[model samples]
Target chain A: MNLWRLPRLRAGALAVWRRNILVWRKLFVPALLMNFGEPVLYLLGLGFGLGHFVGDMSGMPYLAFLASGIIASSAMTTASFEGMYSVFTRMVPQKTYEAILATPLEVDDILAGEMLWCATKSLFSGIAILAVATLLGVVAGWQALWVLPVVFLIGLCFAGPAMIMSSLASNYDFFNYYFVLVITPMFILCGVFYPISTLPAVAQGAVQLLPLTHAVMLTRSLVAGAELTQPVLHITVLAVYAAISYYIAVILVRRKLLV
Target chain B: MWFPPDWPGLSHSNFNRHAITFYNAGSMDTVENEVMAADAPTIRARGLCKQFADRKAVDGIDFDVYPGKCFGFVGPNGAGKTTTLRMAMGLTPLSGGTLTVFGQSIADHASAVRRRVGIVPQADNLDPDFSVEENLYIYASFFALPRAQVEARIDALLAFMSLGDRRRAKTTTLSGGMQRRLTIARALINAPELIVLDEPTTGLDPQARHVIWGRLNELKSRGKTLLLTTHYMEEAERLCDELIIMDHGRILAQGPPRELIERHVEPEVIEVRGEEGAALQELVASSGCRQERMDTSLYCYSRDAAPLIESLKGLHGLKFVHRPTGLEDVFLRLTGRELRDQ
Candidate 1:
């Protein structure tokens, strides 16, 4: 019942994380397609097809502009889907968490394991897109290696809040409302496809409040070799959102399942 | 409750606790547990309570479970049996009062406590993705057990549960009985001192139930403590050394199954079915014996059924059955014959 009380976590959380890795390895083929295929399509189909007529965006070629945006967008969806759909299946119908709870692991350990696994999948999507975009000769530098750690942070940034949504969901259909209402809208508005400056003043202000806005600003800055307006501020905001949402999500899930 | 045809001397008072055929004091896995059984209680609860929005599931009950004894919680469905077990395992937080395991508070030392204990939950929650042996390996990994040691234990446990042939089979492909046996094997993977099972054989066929019962008795004979809940009076009568009959989140009675039956019911009972006869009913009521009436059956209990039978001798179409009273008669008498949670 204590909102601020930190759950006593242990290193055993990694056991749960390892379990997921084994399952992912078992289903390697489809998982690889899902993680890598869609973003590649969006990049090549939209980047080359749409980049043909349109020339440059923000002093960069249209293909280069969309590449970093695709990394941020794809990372967001991959992490969010893991936190929502996969986590929901394990938590509810599969009853996996309940089995874990019977052992030495606490509910906190299970949630931490789920969050780490979600972030890992997100990191996979981000790295795959970045690799393809580099081979296309659209963007490359030693500076892009720094994008790996930042993309991992971006995965973590979206994971906690997406799990909060997962803790709220009752079934798979509930995630549609989340994607349509929250995720897809954030995808379009967070400067992923173009600059946020083109939007109306109030809409731009509202977009600034979204988590993906900060995520895209950080990864895109590192990917496109552009100077960020305030790098520390964006990173801090994402980290704070991740922390606060994570705390609230733990409490909410405890209420939902442990009652 | 099944007795083999060869063991005619096995009575309720001296079943298998002494001179067990399969298990003996010399063969106990750990001698430390045999000594620990003398002093400290394995589980203790005081003024325990669990409250929902408007009702309490476990309403302020006190009990103690000593080591080397099979204690039972017997109640109808929705009588808070599972809730109480969940609290002990630290899966659910107690709304009020104190519960301790192995002399440590469950709330404060849950992980340390759970590390030594094993749980067989009410439902089958085996991982569908893993093989039988893989399931055992994955579960053992939680305890951080050494791989080499666990590999040997898994092989022995598979054979113990008669799952050796199904080591590589998917959990989903096993029959219900095999799945139940696998779950029991999984629970014993760590060789825990205390095992808590909730309705272990609820949905199984009679043969599966008998198999699990035999395994549980073997564990008990080896001096592993057991705490279980069941609506089957026969299960409680056979497995538990002491049991409590619970209803509506409260215990109605607690003692050895034989002692509880004796305390709550007469030793012999006569049942009369068919025919509505005010004359026969009045004769039995005036004869000073206990009586319970259902739709068409009227049960009369006394030290002797001869007088009651002699009085109702000529009642037309009325059938009579005389037999020794058992734990089911006491359970029905204490809890009453009514559909709970309706």
Candidate 2:
């Protein structure tokens, strides 16, 4: 492919973003109340209410620590929601990919467009949760600004592999196994609500293998204004995963669309 | 004014004024007319072929589609008609040969070629998410047309397809015929020079098919090129300037429908449906008409059918009808009755 094709890819990406915005506008209010409300309720009930006995966690306020974890987890959730559900439906049930391929656009354009759309959704969802966390006085300093971009990167990282899975999935029932076996375990073991060190040494090592673990760790470090030393390592790990996953997604899309 | 020798109105002038005016007018007319008359073929294909694994779908075929002509591809199922059309539009890769639209190869200039061609697929692939008018607008946007121009074209195409009243209705809400019409309107949004329809009226009722044919004819009158694939012989007869009959990935025949029928089938055909196998054969042989017998029917080919009918009158359990030969007869004569599983 020529480097000059970047403009076309960018245009396609923008088009997908516009389509996502349309879908969001139609389903936004209900989705926001559910996604935002559930986490906030968790914060109020578990963070504040339980903090009276548990006190500070890992030398930080329980609410702040918990808030950062929620932001990271929700970023993954948002990207996965769009990538696994909406993207899968469009690829299979809706047959949208078949229609798009009939145009002058190619498979690479479709993959880039979909990945960008997933990233945008994750970014918005992450920001919404972050703002709520601020109202509760959990965030600190300018590091919060970095949270947005990192969340976007994290969302993109998951989106690439998730899209590949979506393309391969045979039916909606297959997604159930994916969520139950892969996603649920990652959420529990990735230090989303508690420190991973509390788990057994083997379990802690297993958590490190997950992309979400690096994302949650990096996001928590940034939101709480902690030292930046280990955050760089986390960012590197996430970036590697994202690049590899994206390449796989592009290949799968090409095979499916062109063939 | 002084009288001049053999000069009427120009007698008073030193120069012949009409000659100068005529010369200048004729020169300008020729210059303007030359450019307009030089328009070339809008689509051309040479030795185009497509193969799938072990089988060839479309094999080395060549043709030129002049502007404003309704070109038809007539073939039975699995004859490579759709595959050929798809290759022409760059929707499918060509296994061999080349196709050019507006004098440019599709491989080298896809975007430019696609901008001038619109396609209606055999299956309905309408965007179920958008309303009727929105579907047109979004498709136009892919061509990067201006928003104002897109909206204007959407309105015009909707009115042209008689879907103005249902512009805002979701695609799922529309009837099958309505959806097909909307798909046609969508194809016209960019003012394509050539429109390719793959089985456009396959499942439509007779009334709807006629309506679609009317729309296609209207487009033809406006000087738009149409390339369509259909199994309906009557449609090809009614709409096409010329067509090709294909089978087993090869062109069996190509010409005007009537000419193909005349060339391949006799002037009249006597169809015999009965159990009098030996008697029917004897009648055909004695009547001097060439005959072919299938499992259920006997076809007797001749210029005059009355003699064949009279010869067959004594055959027991014989029922027959005589009719003028048609494209169907030509098709049956060439391809036979073997079923092709696509």
Candidate 3:
């Protein structure tokens, strides 16, 4: 990339990151702690406590399996929170996007900056959760390092769709329908807590269509030191979905903000 | 022509020296004979129009905003003043005709045109997440100014707008007037050649409005051009070097304030307040002056008001007063008294 274009995108992204960090600093410390602490409590309370009952499933420790699933889930959750909730509020309620666009920054710069910011936040939260899981003896080997890139891919996939949903959503109430119908089903039925193969054949086929299921399977297999087979297929499917969702999001934001 | 002889007050040497000086001054004048031409106008609009569905928000309108002049657009609500101004800044697309800023078409070179113009929208659009200084610095960054230059400009603007004390305050914490001033300050971050204001003093108090007017005059002294849309007649009269009175998306009249009032209205106006009946109409018909009826008041326009007032003195239940006609009377006459569907 040309040096001039790089700074344009980098400056826009850094400005957004700095602004969000300032806001996060002003939020109550307890609120910030709770947001980071919830998943750790889940890891211990569910991964270890529940693993005691179902030990050594799928030839891997139950705690290890659950830890991988938590990392993928954390990536999606953090990206979704930033891409959907915060972006929507800034677009409609706060009118922050209007204020920014009034400057010389183009729509492409703003969208790219926002996506990068969401990815950064999700990556930070994912690594923190992964580090905590390692200390708890849940992650097994150096193979866990692969989870970082996988979590980043998951964040990108979720961010694209979340941005589109945010642009279409008219009010906070409209988000409830999306949360109940799309997000909740993906979390529960996509094998976050159990293997998809354990479910019926029909359920397994249905879970295969979801982005989260592919992410969870990839993260879990990588963390368990399992042999990699046809991994390119998983990566290809995610890349295609992310590309199409991003195209749609960019068009929608341009129509909504620029017009 | 023969030169006149020296007068008693001057000696012959003095006369000769004065003649030589005059001849040298005339020769230097020919050497520097090129006239200082006026700078080109900053904004030129011709037949600009905008339509929303079936309603024409801006009809065909033509005007020019010159450099270093405070140009005012005055009209009642829904007069297309803001629509026209937005089109000039390339914020809103024109339905028809051409608008050029700094000699470039708004359609073909919108970003380039926007680079030379600053806008203060009718409503405050400050970023809530950033502090006052951050808001200004971010705007400067949009123009791709260097970090050091942006910081210097931010400091200068903050002090100029009297906002140094509120540099760290969030936008939501500022008062209405403070926010308005901050918006103006943000517009100046880029140091644009032309600054467009859309009803900048709509809700400000008298004191705040005066402060803004004073700053605008200072900007004018520094050779900055201003295009403002306002409904306050007094504001138009006070600050505008030249003005356009618009109604129904068309220019009703345009000139200096005094010239516009002189052309469109009379030098003096006698206002009569009474119920309109046969007697009032008969009195007005026989008054022998240019007259217009608005609601319950009859405005008789003339260079002299005493004759009209003397004729109405004996009328019953009538209150009459004489005052100078102004831009408001011109606007009401051109746009009429009917409420517009804004």
Candidate 4:
């Protein structure tokens, strides 16, 4: 009934962010290894093994084309997982949100802090993937560094939806549906492994509606040092998803935490 | 609305307004010295209620908690004690009526009121991933206390709670009692004016319970206002300056513990057990005393027990013990002896 209740950003958010950082600092080693290790295996297994036959796509080697897409997609997966699994654990099993709410921090503070933390985590994973791809000669010129900030924005975009899911989740089992129905479809159809242009016209049109498609397209242009046309349009699409999802996520989290 | 003047991030003018208002409201010296004169109530609720669907979790209830006094809410499970506490702490919204903390409405100024209060929840929801010190540090950050200021109190608080040796251990590694103590310690990190505790010693052993009670008494003696809920009648009698007995989301009686017992039940009680109770009860039927029967025991209440004991001499097979009536007798008399559970 009170859908027009406006949400404001406050200072207590940093406290929640600091709490997560303190805990994450203790477990960063294994976390970093997974973030870096997974993309490396995918790049080797799919890019090299599958690229032998595909050769080149649109005047670039298949491995190079695939590497940029992985950078964008990896950030998506990392942020989504952090927002869903980790946020759920903190909210439900651990009761971290309950403890924080007892203090001066409001529901809005916890929501903003959680989203920022997930985005920060996504940035970490994306950077590691980029470094590995560069060492393997899949990256183009220094212009590829521009992909870092774009990867962070992709993380924020996915984190918003994943957090909305966390707010509605009753148990961990519900997350499997999200992965199978939402994440898997995007991973396959958003041009991560191959160009979506090869799919049917209807499928390609549907792919453009997905947030991952814009992330992949923008990252590919930046990583390949290609002069991109309508670059603002691509960035705006990702930014719009991030902003709208963030607004909805905040509303959902407020309802869940403040009864 | 009253945010603590020292908490970080408040605008300079807002801090000045809070300081001047609270000074006029007489909450500025909340914990520093004994309040010799009459003080204003730290919390007030008038017709406060909370509804979930068709059920009333906390039906219209009223109470006042004065500064430097300990107020206790004693009730059985599902009696709306926790719901009322949650509302007072701004963890949940009020369904109807007015509730205020430090003279400011909770519904209108929850965030500001929350900044000036502390809470120890019934459950030990400490961060299991952090060490004891880290738990304290993270909680202090919620109040926006400077790292240096929080650091200054860490050692003192840990030692005061007898958690000094376990400061470096993960919270999950601590025993149940230790974790509860740590939770209490965490609540005091902000030096709050009003501390709300929900069943602070519900599951502790006798020794641990006494230790926590001793610490709570110390906090009270230092002039900190305390509002707590407990199922233990003895705890309410020993610690509360004033207490309320609640049932079915309503207040049954409200007054000092001793006064309530004195006003509700007789001065003395004789509990008789075994099959001979009915026989003994018949003999005292003409003694002008009152009796109530439980499943296996008969409780006799009288102003004088000497004549009652004399009347029971011939009924030699029954076991009986006489003692002064306590808050438990008053509570049972007010709320009835029925089990209150879903």
Q: Which residue pairs clash within candidate 4?
A: none
DockQ metric for all predictions? 0.63, 0.24, 0.20, 0.64
As a TM-score, model 1 comes out at: 0.90
Candidate 3, residues B251-289: lDDT per residue as tens digits?
A: 888878887787777788888876677876787777777
Q: Which parts of model 3 are misplaced by more than 4 Å?
A: A1-14, A28-31, B1-39, B273-282, B312-318
List model 3 lDDT by residue over A162-186, tens digit each.
8888899997777777778887888
Q: TM-score: which candidate is best?
A: 4
| Residue B47, model 1: Cα distance from true site in angstroms | 1.3
Q: Which stretches of candidate 2 lie over 4 Å from their true place?
A: A1-8, A44-54, A141-143, A197-209, A230-240, B1-41, B274-278, B293-295, B310-319
lDDT of 2 by residue, A120-222 (tens): 8788878777878888888887778899999988988888878878877887777787778878888888988788989999998888889898998888888
Which candidate model has the greater TM-score, 1 or 2? Answer: 1
What residue pairs clash in candidate 2, if any at all? none
Model 1: CAPRI class: medium
| lDDT per residue (tens digit) for residues B1-342 in model 4 | 222233223433454455456456555565212221233358889999999887998999988787778999999888899999988987777889789899888877888887888899999999989999999999999999988989988988999999999989999899889999999999999988899999999999999999999999999998899999999999999999888899889999888887888889999998887655466657778777898877787788999988888877767666788999999899888888887776
Q: In terms of DockQ, which candidate is strongest? A: 4
Assess each prediction's global lDDT (C-alpha) against the native.
Answer: 0.83, 0.78, 0.77, 0.85
CA displacement after TM-score superposition, residue B340 of candidate 2 (Å) = 3.4
lDDT at position B104, candidate 4: 84
Q: Which regions in candidate 1 have their CA more than 4 angstroms from the true location? A: A1-4, B1-38, B274-288, B307-319
What's the CA error at residue A23 for candidate 4, in Å? 1.0
TM-score of chain B of each: 0.85, 0.85, 0.82, 0.87
Residue B256 accuracy (lDDT) in model 4: 81
